[model samples]
Target: MNPNVTVINPTITEDKESKIRVAAYCRVSTNSEDQQNSLITQMRYYENFLSDSETERLVSVYADEGITGTQMDKREEFQRMLKDCRRGKIDRIIVKSISRFARNTKDCLSVLRELKELGISVMFEKENIDTANITDEIMVTVMGGLAQEESASISNNVRWGIRSKMKNGTVKFHSAPLGYDLYEGNLIINKREAEIVKSIYKMFLSGMGYDSICRELNESKVIKNDKGTKWLSASVRYILTNEKYIGDSLWQKNYNTSMPYRKVRNKGELEKYYINNTHEAIITREEFEKVQELIEQRKHPNMNLINNYPLSKKIYCGKCGSLFKRRFKNEKSYWICREHYYNAENCRTKPILEQVFYTAFMTMYNKLKANYSVIFTPMLTQLQELKNKKYGSNKQYIEINKEIAQLKEQTHVLARLKTKGFLDVSKYIEQVTEINAKIEKLNRELRKIVRCDDEDEMIEQIKEIASIIENGTDLMTEFDDVMFESLIEKIIVKNQTEFEFNLIGGLKFTENSIDNCT
Candidate 1:
């Protein structure tokens, strides 16, 4: 070895001979038998290949069926795989094609860039592209662009085919709404289901609410939906409002708009076709119109009763963690747990009479007002120190350190240039002095950039809280909405007898029943 060169042991930088963790992702755009078979085949091939490989360790195989690749949110398996990759549970991912991974070019490129930063790679078998190779990125981008365009084209073509049939009055949507059955592309009323539909409409017109109708149907054990679940208020309203029961068909009431398509209700976004007498009537048109009018009337029954209560959503149940809704009983206003009011079994806590809760709250507020400084002074000091430490360890300090390293490297380069006769000695000295002066200035700025006092922020928060509440030590005789809103965050009811009041600034104090309060 040359005397000028320093020698070190080779073990420190040697690559470890660990097996690579590999996973495969597969997806099919349709749920057709043929496409499903193809997806299963692809999954089996990957499983066998990874299992048989000597260098690769099989991690997982994530598959999504009948989900379009354009939208990542809809694909559960794809999202789970990405999450696993983020958590370092996956080292490499293999997909059959770029389209299988993601058809949206922006999403595909963004995911690849993030994976690159994580030292993870994705292998697209059909394109023979590896994301780890820097040179392959441009090619991958081009391929991803084509795949996105292809998906859009396929979506447009499918829409076009449907629109053509719709224009000819032969379009068929495979939905099978409540009282209708598809027979040779025409909706025919199923008498069994139609009777149930008729009964729902009659019940609605006879002054029964949606909830009451739901309870009646559930009590009778009428299997409502295709899933055989008990009727819900929304489903009851759906059956009541359906135009199909009135012997008409409305087509294209909803449509998917643009690439990475989202299905949205068509409120004149697109043309809708209405066909008259498309099916046998379950209910008369007059009855349907009457129900619609009744629905409109019920929507704003208490429009004049405006809520001015500031603590309407602020107060919460201590037992079930539900909000306390204002209720009026026998000319008295009280706050009760909404869950308990709806179902007592869910929240067994007794209602905290509004006057009783108000007194306890005021007593606690008076105590906080008297001891504010004793509680807040030490807290402010601790927070100030933490803020200073955070500023010191911030991003600016890291960037400044990197810049200083680069400046030092440039000075060394200047020295080499002077020795090689490429730079004049005087010129080299001048450049070195200027660079050192810049470095010194940067170092001074870096030091001051850290250690900043957040006293202004701390003081502003305290001032806001102080401004919202009265500054005196006198106990509040009645409920002060301003004081409650400013100081109280939430009240957790432990039971009927006790509850904990959590304050805005992470302070908590417990209070007992009305009998225990002074």
Candidate 2:
């Protein structure tokens, strides 16, 4: 909740005179602390926006932080003003824009209806939208829908663009694992770190299981990935299986077309693109081929190695017991028996949708929720640790270290070039952008450090979600698609009676006997 600002009720000395007791309201949806400037700018602009209001005015500023425009009920400031309006305290609300007011049609109408009943007016500056005029509601309803669609389109385009880049091998994982460093601006081949990669590869090749390799890496006192911690088998397998090392990019492995929150994986249904040969290779083609062969065999070259895709390895046709490779057709995703697609009589069942299986599995979502509630806690703890330690690291300290290193290296190169007379002062100044980039990164990282409270804000989101769910029954009679999607992933229709559903996070699933279990 933002600070509750009170507007000093203006002097009504003259019976016929109208007075303006005005205040401003501003909002920015991003959780970024950098948006502080933007919010301030908007508030100040609104203060000026109502400067010449000649009517009876009682304006006060109400703000919501990192809040969505899709809904109005979650906004504490907006709701507070509504309460004030109900008590006949406020006369007008000054918003910066319609999008600031709402992106959802239903929310825009509901709030405007509330204010209309209270005879309170809302003025939006961007589209010159005013709630007082009854016609403005119609315009807002149409425009807000367009705005929401535009936002969704941009999100889809961005996801596609990212997948394309990944396919082209231009976009690699942001963090190179501990064993290798990204070199040549585009290639990852850290000599010191590469040794660890080689060690891991060797262990996998020699048949040492991933868990054993993790233990070995820890026991060897080797530095873990950028995240300072012990290695785990899952992480090891992820690295081992990543095709990035061999220079082939599998693009479009995931996509985020779903809305409200556009994360590719959390959504039960996401599309992925697979592109090949994106960058300089770290492992030889022969080595990559060998690894793939070993992967197919489900054998680790070392005694300590193990394969995680054991089931995938033995995915044979139910009828012929031949390999039933996964395949897709048209725009629909499915897994048909290869023999059937090739020779219809050779297969048992027809080509079935992978998503159908997923949906069937998800029919058990309600039963799974209880189990998820338990697993969510520990999973959240471990995930946060990994995100902070690996992705974030001692982010500030590491950023400074990088800047100092860049400055020293670039400056030394400039000195050498000067001594050899191969580069002039002008050339040195013009070509020092890498060093400048480092400085800029340093500044960004420094500014970010001041807003460590971001974590707290994220944690508090649980309460906000709970509040929404509590009010959901009253808000709408029907089920909310977004909330259900946010909680559940795909349900696997493993068989007619044995479908399995998965949750968004590492939530554990507890299966109960379904009414129509196969």
Candidate 3:
């Protein structure tokens, strides 16, 4: 029986041989014909390579076209591949090189470490480095650094070339602005869009703000850019400020940075080229200069507040909480809610006449003067009584202050305990958080008491307002800008026929505009 015994070699079963799930990632920075062909070739190569291997199963070939490799976030296909790997869809990743994976060294190692932790591996074909086989990432780090350096070098060269072209006035306009077309390396006026541009400038110069201009353009169904997008304030502002409309070109207004690649405004970080007569003029330079001056004037608070547009920042819409902008129609100034002016559907508040505001102020001031004692004296008494009630006994205030002091002492004790290792960090944090929350609630009660103490300030402001109203002319027959600016804080438009005058000390008085003012 011993002589007849035979050893049977174990046969490998099909179910025991598990194939590695593989995914390929490829990226081309540009969509040039050559790059497109390279991407297609890479896809075919990955397909054939995986198909020929019995131990590998092809999962997907992720390709990102016309995307920069320096920033991993910008590569959609690369991120998608990582997401799939995280979901355990693939066991192995294949990339052409470290540069294709990431030009950022940190991003490369971070992703590699994550994959290694998942028991997954990455093979860089050109570098002949497999993450699974390598004991450490020193070589990968060095290669990634070199790749980053190469990217920075290429970026510098490209930037230099662009600046050189800009200096020589040989740079081509790849895409023309809203008013022009790029033709033969020059900006040629596109008549249709140019008209829109002209209208925008005209409206802006004619006292229409950006929102109003955008609204008018959108209402007219005017196409903005080639995308036919709806007009926005930002787009209108760009059209207004762009020097291209004045037959000039300003190059390198924005430039790119290398390490963490991003485009930033030049802002004197680099030289900018300003060439004249680069295109036909959409608006005269004088008009453009005037528009610039107006923009500056409107932007300056002193100019808008004290010099021009007295009511610019003083009017509000009670219905929609929007500022009321001044618009002149038929030689009469009207104040309409900015939201209502832009889109009537958003806000239905009707425009109020500027004269109505003036008359409303006069009437409110007169009424205040007539019944100053009846109106403000009781208010002052009420405010004083309320203040006294809050701090009269001083018991609640004292208790809150005492508790806050005790909490502060407790915090100091906790800090000392933490410093001496008498209390663990987690317990200390919990105790300190509870103490601070109690201290915060007590502080809030203290703040309420302090606010009540502001009664004297309010009483003084009301007295000053009364004195200003009474010491002046007996009858306010004419609208006085000086008095209105001095006394009125804000005029809230309640509706088409009513206005609420919020006086300097927060006294609100409503006036009927339909009967007299309007």
Candidate 4:
């Protein structure tokens, strides 16, 4: 034996072999039948070709149809293919070309990098390029860059065509909001829907109330946003509030979130475009202005009316994740946080009146409803904690730890009463009912501090129900709490002073519910 070479015992170890699985991704963006046929042919060809090849094995074939390759998301087959690659089931991925893989440069490079890290290869048949090949990386980068440029070109071309149409007054938008429809590629009046729209406008201007309008719509079986569905006060108000029903169309209100498949709300970072006379007019400018006037009136402190618009439902208490209820004092309106309403532990937040803390809201509602312009501050305090007067400020968040002793005492009393078992079923029920009624009454009293208008119609409806059962009824009279529930959508009880609420959109006038206080 040579001095440098030494003999050693040979040892054999089992290799943990993974399955040589393969999956192919096929995509066709266009909805044309011919393109669809081409996709089917590609899928079948890959399936048969891989299965027939001696060195290759067919594991699965995922096909995404009628989805743009330029977009990374909204592609089921592509996602599945990537999933298999990550799960080690797919050792190789075969696609038609670089464009089929991804037209966006960053997306293609990121996906390629991931697969490369897993020792996987993507084969592009048209370019005759494989990730396993030495030259594939450089070629793919160039090809992917070209594909991305092409996608941008196509997008610009489409945008240009649409803009041209808009300039020529030929482009049309069919989202009628609620009161209008497309008539011969232009917006036109639908008589019945128009009447309802007009009614909402009148009610808003007169400050009748969103809850009343919602009840009226539901009673009249007004169609929902679409054909058949229940009406929501928010939806009803959205129709009344949307400006596109007039002649002006606001485009570019939002921007593309990502290169492929996501959209985010416009954060005012991008510029927006507005096109007038883009389509036929549904309502005249005078009518539109009149409707706006009504909206402004409802928001006015003097009107003291509730708005039934969809986006009006959100009133959050930054202190606790509770809703605030709307309140009215005299002719002025304010939103009261709900934590204070129920006397819950987290109720130390400050209160804001209509004339206080005006620098907060920047939404469309604030712009439309400019009722209180005084901008004074409030001095509401609970348990000796100060809170900001801003609508959604989270500055004074605190952990509440009060009322533990009271809760413990109540629990002990309940336990002792239950153990006694001396009372009959009806007597027990009566006792429990009395306690519950007391608690409910107390809670309502506390909630009254955070005023939420349930509209005159819903409030009266509940009163009518209570009136019909005036024969000195038992606890059954209080069993139906639907009136309270029907009137309030969500009461965000934020701290002790702030709260918010929304009224019900669909209401049946014949609906029966009981509340002791009308």
Identify the leading candidate in terms of lDDT: 3
Once superposed on the true structure, which residue ranges of model 2 sit more than 4 Å away at CA?
1-123, 131-144, 159-191, 225-229, 265-277, 299-518
lDDT (0 to 1) per candidate: 0.73, 0.56, 0.77, 0.55
> What digit string (tens of lDDT, one per residue) describes model 4 on residues 1-518?
66797788647533323335567778776656688667657766776676656556867667777666676777856876787788878788888888878887788889988999998988888878888774456677888888777777766666677667656656666456566777755677777777777777666556545556776877887765432444544455555656676667765554444455344444476555567766545556776787667656544344433444222344567676666676666665565567766785666655555333222212212321232222111111221122122212422221111233343334334423443344454765566676666655554443343223333233334332222222112222221212232234544433333333333432221111121110
Candidate 4 versus the native: TM-score?
0.46
- Model 2 scores a C-alpha lDDT of 0.56
TM-score of candidate 1 on Cα atoms, chains taken together = 0.45
Instruction: Score every model by TM-score.
Output: 0.45, 0.43, 0.52, 0.46
Decide which is better by lDDT, 1 or 3.
3
C-alpha-based local distance difference test score of model 3: 0.77
Error of 2 at 264 (Å): 3.7
Among all candidates shown, the one with the greatest TM-score: 3
State, as a TM-score between 0 and 1, how close model 3 is to the true structure: 0.52
Q: How do the residues 3-113 of candidate 1 rate in per-residue lDDT, one tens digit apiece?
A: 787788666542333678898898888776698767767767787787767778878777788767778988877887888889998889999888888887889899999
Off by over 4 Å in 3: 1-18, 40-51, 57-59, 174-176, 180-192, 211-233, 276-281, 284-290, 293-518
- lDDT, model 3, position 67: 63
Give the lDDT of residue 249 in candidate 4. 75
- Of candidates 4 and 2, the better by lDDT: 2
